[model samples]
Target chain A: MTATATNKQVILKDYVSGFPKESDFDFTTTTVELKVPEGSNSVLVKNLYLSCDPYMRTRMGKPKPSTALAQAYALGQPIYGYGVSRVIESGHPDYKKGDLLWGIVGWEEYSVITPTPDVHFKIQHTHVPLSYYTGLLGMPGMTAYAGFYEICSPKEGETVYVSAASGAVGQLVGQFAKMMGCYVVGSAGSKEKVDLLKTKFGFDDAFNYKEEPDLSAALKRCFPKGVDIYFENVGGKMLDAVLLNMNVHGRIAVCGMISQYNLENQEGVHNLSNIIYKRIRIQGFAVFDFYDKYSKFLEFVLPQIKEGKIKYVEDVADGLEKGPEALVGLFHGKNVGKQVVVIARE
Target chain B: MTATATNKQVILKDYVSGFPKESDFDFTTTTVELKVPEGSNSVLVKNLYLSCDPYMRTRMGKPKPSTALAQAYALGQPIYGYGVSRVIESGHPDYKKGDLLWGIVGWEEYSVITPTPDVHFKIQHTHVPLSYYTGLLGMPGMTAYAGFYEICSPKEGETVYVSAASGAVGQLVGQFAKMMGCYVVGSAGSKEKVDLLKTKFGFDDAFNYKEEPDLSAALKRCFPKGVDIYFENVGGKMLDAVLLNMNVHGRIAVCGMISQYNLENQEGVHNLSNIIYKRIRIQGFAVFDFYDKYSKFLEFVLPQIKEGKIKYVEDVADGLEKGPEALVGLFHGKNVGKQVVVIARE
Candidate 1:
């Protein structure tokens, strides 16, 4: 074991409301061991590529009575998120030095993970770009796969609608549905994303939801027959409008509700009555619940990636210092595809 | 063949806004045929017990662009709901004179149904009271059975919670959970209903939601370890509170949101974030979607009913004149149990 040393970390300054600022996280140096401690069941990881997910925005807020997924980030503590990392040292038997893994790691590069590791997986298939593990082959990829297949239960020739069409999960979901022989439509905030969804991701149709004044009418125009399945990534108004245009027995897979994450006051869904009237099924699911199927997902997705049957697009920020901006960009729809921050290439 | 004659019917006077009034419906003497006309594949039936469900309140309003299940009732036309009826005559090959069926029927003494006769099912189980067709062995029964068994996926020794506990669906859900060896808890509006849940329906615990100042605390008291399955019949504050007390991987079957039905603005759910952290699955479902399982449900529930392993309660309001009030009573938690209006006994 190497000698213990101090490390620098980025700690959450305070809980945020609405949109978060860079000042919300403070970069500070603190003493820490570079090596794993003796007899400890922990690993020392150096985060390479940190994922900027929209859901992390909710974690920046104060601990509420019912924040979904996990507890709020503690004040003055290192804020953590999904990151692809190299294990510098390991005291646990399952992992060894130089082994690669992707899991929850602190924002600042180094982390000491103890007792409960959040959805950690060993990187077995290294043929793809390592950064691909940050988005396409990691949490976001699993989210799109499980949420669409397991939750939405898409059928061939069905009309599928996806919100946040160019985001990590949304883009993949639309593509997967299209591959399943479904008529897929996607909604984005900008014309750029709309084009990417239609041309790049191969969505049957794509629209800029921000440009449309009447979302329900826009949906009706896109899906004259009504949407058979909706991949709900952005909640609030989009959800309300989608409820109106959902066909009888439509299925909605609630992956994440980006629109409501940073709001001081969450938007109310007005057309919930459609859930009963149309006999629609709206289900909220987390990727972790489908971890048992991860091996199977990898078996399926990896071949597609290798064969060029599946294409992934990423908006990679250069450094860890720009991580907050990359993350906040998700809310404003600035990131065109999967928002990721590459702290280091090697 | 019997001569065709117009029959008297009950019509919605106008669209209702908040709590419905007695004047919302008018029983007008209109003539209807006792027999189906030639060249039309339709059925003419004499309505027996008309079900006064809380969902009917939504139909009293003007046709919104997105009402899910049943279409909005046309102004000056008779309101319709689930009912048990005797097929007096039929032009459809599937039905003939004197066939007993239960399905969508006018809130009057008779109705003419056409085009789709698949929604209607012949009454195979007749040992129980025919009024059971209005609830158990009908839509509400299938709702309780499917919503609990199919959606919630209860396991033995799991903690289950049912809102609107003494109502048509909730009562049966609680008893079904108990039969499955689950620790069932229920919430109702009044002490009588609460007592009925515990003493009559075999719920492990029951509370009057109206009396509880803190719904979350009440849930904590009932489920010290947290609820594993929640049958959500009443939405709004109850849903918000239940979110806080849900165990990891908990399942919530959204059967109905009766609490938010009449409100001009739907209540915002403040605790939805719990859904992500606890890995909870909140799914909205309708009984109609589970129609394929109707026979299976009857096979399961009928024997339980015969053995007195399951008990059902009904609040029967006599005459079509009291129907509007009885239907509206559901929203305010005024009805003691399953609110039903007996149009005729024989």
Candidate 2:
């Protein structure tokens, strides 16, 4: 790269409060050289697929003193997330030109990555859909695996509950629990998602939490004996209800709390006393910390995928301009399955 | 064995709301056969000491329609807790007449117990004060050991924070953390408790949270870098503040939430998102669950006690009549250390 060139990007227009609107993000095109600068240990990569996640909503807001995990996206910088890409040019010794990798990349068509070795992982298995690297083979996949196996420590014949059931991580978690001989139940926002949980993902039971006025009662009806583990994705009233229906020594693996992320004030869980009395273990985990186990996760999940033991669905929005809307769609449960933005097919 | 004479005891008067009063528990006398009925595998024991724990306050209230864990206390029954006793008569094969043991007995003078061998452990170490069976040598001891070692998974030089610092389990936890070369700080309700934490228990630093209006500031002042392990006994606002000051990968062993027990409605923790940000592990544990590790615990703690490396404090009230007051005082933060009611010295 001769001079620093600007890249076309989707910039966060303003901080979001409750539900993110289309006006919150702006897509503008600018020219940039798709190559690494001289004497720099960096690589220029064209973005292939961008992962749309609910956690990205937290980054769209102004940085509050109390906000945990991620910083707010700057007013005009490109919104970022996990993306699958190809290295077009390389300045680092380990990475070479035309190496495929998946890690943190920008929302634009091309990103100049400073090749942080710890953050990026080189792609080994290319047989699976490259978009699978955006989800089932990537962050969401590891999240479901580690959050279930390590945090939940699920036992066979135990009753398992997954909220946001048809979403990326929730769908996989429900499947994983079922494979372990658990009685899996999931709650989604719509009839379609609920039906998908039972028919597509093999959940023992599925319910539309939106239609159920009494969530706790619905949980009781589904799990007469009480739930042994809860995969908490959508926090708030659902969390409060699940707490009431959890069996003694129940484990809650908190992967994401999408319901509370966008709210001005987070909902209070009234039945937290259950945690003490029933000896329930509620643990929060990040997939980044579980990167060490990624290879092991791949070893386990890859074979399952090859044999059709595991299946995945993607809701892909084409073009960089649609990236902002696709990312925002996650907060409102707009995506049918794994919401991914396809910047390029190859 | 013969029919037992009438025994006087304190029974829960009614379901409690807000702060408990002495009048909530009525002192009454009731008749019962001390001997185990023919062919019944049960033991009758005279309660020697009664333990007053903060958790009992939750049990005294009206049961919420939520979790089975929050079962309401039955009216007119003697309040129950861990009590050290001598076996007066036995039908159980494992326990003989005059055998000393510690387990769930009753608030009254004598109890006919259906011995659950797994729960009731034999008092092997008679060298220590038998009343220590009510606390440091009993449930509280196992709680501190298991919560610190198993839940916290502490390392040397790690920063540890204990809430309710001078109470039964908190005192031992602080000492255990200290013994492991952890930088230990604790929070209590009173100046006396703060002093006890520093002088008697050897806490690295101590603060009276009641006096400190800004808990986050206090935590920041004490732990500039942030706390690695937080032993949570008190919940509500304290928990909210601690969340802000927790270091990444922090482990929180939730033993009790005494602050929320008496509140008619539970307080919402505002900073729960910090758990995700910090990748904190918050696990709720019951001492009863860790009974299997008691033998191992005794093996570790007994040596330390014998070598004068470990010390303990007890706040004992004489006579069974004061049991109600002793138990109620826990909520008010009146007890200096392990609060025990001694029915008789000999």
Q: Return the top candidate by lDDT.
A: 2
Can you write out model 1's per-residue Cα lDDT over B1-346, one digit (the tens) per residue?
5676656678989888877777877878777767678888999988778887887877777777666565688999888888888888889888888888888888888898862543688887778888898898888999898899898989999999999889999999999898899999999988889899989999999998888999999999999999999998888888888988998889988888888777777777766656566767777777777889988888888888899888899999887777777887777888887788887777
Q: After superposing candidate 2, which stretches have Cα over 4 Å from the reference?
A: A1-6, A64-68, B1-6, B31-40, B63-72
- List pairs with backbone clashes in candidate 2: none
Candidate 1 structure lDDT: 0.85
TM-score of each: 0.90, 0.94
- Encode model 2's per-residue lDDT on A1-76: one tens digit a residue: 2544566788887888889988988987788775677799988888899999888888887787655578888887
Stretch of 10 with least lDDT, candidate 2 chain A: A1-10
lDDT of 2 at A56: 89
In angstroms, how far off is A67's CA in candidate 2?
A: 4.7
Computed on C-alpha atoms, the DockQ of candidate 1 is: 0.50
* Cα lDDT, model 2, residue B23: 92
Docking class of 2: medium
Instruction: Report iRMS values in order.
Output: 2.5, 2.0
RMSD each, Å: 3.2, 2.4
